[model samples]
Target: MIIDCHNHVLATALPPGHDRFVREMRAPGHRRAGRLPAYRPATDEDWVGLEGDLDPIDPGTLVDDHVSAGVDRATVLAVAPSTYTAYGERGTIDLGRVTDVDGPLEVAKSNDYIASLTRRHPELIGMSAVNPKFRGVEWARDELTRAVGELGLQGLKLYPMYDHYAPADRDLAFPIYERAVELGIGVMVHMGTSSAKDTVLDYGRPGALDEVARHFPDLPLLVCHAGFPWVDECLAMVARHDNTYLDISMFATKSTQRQLYEFLLRARQLGCPLSRICWGTDYPGGGKPAVLLPKLTLVNDVADPGAPISRLDVANMVGGNWARFAGLTDWSEQETLEQLEAWEPRWRDS
Candidate 1:
């Protein structure tokens, strides 16, 4: 099936005034101010007019959007930015200050929220979020067990960029990785630049995952965003490591169509198996799939002059490969549509 391996259930409410962080990230040019020239915000008008449609951010709407867009399943990923700036060693926490404390609790709440949603929505899979530096290694291990064993999460999401640490920093994260290996869950590392204020760009180098993959060996390692500007390095990593996979999340966009298509073509030319690629919309950050799916489909179907990519290659890149990698069973987009014919009569023709 078309399983969106990376998505977020945009929380409608944040702890007090924490919405600014989300807003800053979503604000036009804020994410690429120092990077892309077209996105560089030069004035108040440039920033203010950039505020696009303000759609309601909730799980139900997200699911409806997915179903309407022909995606059968989605993995709702949780993010805990507070973990990096508040509860971890990358920064100091001010207990008495606003937006300064309760990183662990915030993460727990986010995980619980996803768990609750996934419990009700069979199409949704919840991936747990945990900071390896929370309290200590022992605490981190126990928390991971609680998240998987108790919370029923099926995947793990890690963002070392926010914490300003390399993905291969085993001293602080090895224990959590070990637990994830034991639980047979994949670990998705956010690679490339982040709009978060305290984020460190260098920490997101896709090569940082090399040591982590080497140490884990058997654990499923997903480098999200195809490592963006470091696409070549990420492709090399996937080629070198048997267990490493890259997800085309935010890259599967209209603006990035050519870049992403060329990367996929080069990846195949470089002998990186299409099976090592996964489809992810990075929903919310990727806007609606309706806008992206068409562009993504074009990338999958079109060819460069006479260098046409096969239909099987396109099929695998969209969903087949993800099912094989995620170990999902009896999954098929067509099968899901058939089931919908019997269940939701109105959706039969859709």
Candidate 2:
């Protein structure tokens, strides 16, 4: 079964008037302009405001897209509402002016909603999002417990850069990490380019993750975005730490994809296992599966060089690796193989 370990689905409950602020913040010439080229504003009727006759952002459509992509399962993450907030140019929140102490609570609610979707569709898994700074240690601990113990979330998503903090700043984040370790929930952190004004490039580097990994050697941690711009460092860190893994999200560009294949080859040459790497389309940010196909083809072509990548390898990226990493093995590889075989003729026909 194929599983996308990292993909985001935006919640429809974005506060009224928030979308305009997010669009303006991302607009060209804006102080918080994101690194990527600006996106056209999403219209009200558009599916998640994306440009394309794509599947809707709801669960049924998401499942359909996965099946179409030959993916049997996917780990869906919630993009934080604060990821859209304009906190000056530095992405820092002015805590004093904020009236909402429910930022973390709202995030938990979104996670629960996604978890419910996953429960309905056994193929989908939910990854919870948390802002350590806003949620703080205690609330973060409780939320992590609830997400795992109650909601059955498979993992946790963090955007330290969006929270105006560095991943290595344990002074403020250690407690949350401690709780995560205690709870045994895997943590997936954003570790590449910034889409917010307050994102500090330095904070997103893979080197900053070393201390955290060292501190929680038992916890499985994934650096999302393949640690772009610092792919080499990320590969090095993954090689050095047994608990670390890399998720290839937002790595659809041909040039970047080639670089990633080279890095994977280098890691293999150094005796690192390919199982340590997983695939993530970053969804919304990555556009549709059709737009991402070329890049996926490149990775597949290079990984095998001659024959196509085995269904197992594809399943590894789609969701198997994540399931293995998360210690959940309810899904059977044999069943996955059966599904793949059932679909193989269709894929060849296409």
TM-score of every model? 0.81, 0.76
Cα misplacement distance, residue 163 of candidate 1 (Å): 2.5
Write the residue-wise lDDT of candidate 2 on 3-116 in tens digits: 677765533233333344344333433322343343564345432433232222555666677768677677888543343344321121212222222444343355556666
Extract clashing residue pairs from model 2: 3-318, 3-319, 4-318, 90-198, 91-198
The TM-score measured for candidate 2 stands at 0.76
Clashes of each: 0, 5
Our model 2 lands, by Cα RMSD against the true structure, at 6.7
lDDT of 2 at 177: 76
lDDT of 2 at 131: 63
Q: Highest TM-score among the candidates is held by which one?
A: 1
lDDT values of the candidates?
A: 0.68, 0.63
Q: Write the per-residue lDDT of candidate 1 for residues 1-350, one digit (tens) a residue.
A: 66788887755223332344455566554445543235454444544544442232466777898888777788888663344362232211121222212445344465666677788788888887777655666776776788789989887888778755567777877877898899888888899766656567988889988888899998998899888878888888889899989988886742477766787788987777877888788888776766565455556444578776555565566676777666667667565344433433333323
How well does model 1 score by local distance difference test?
A: 0.68
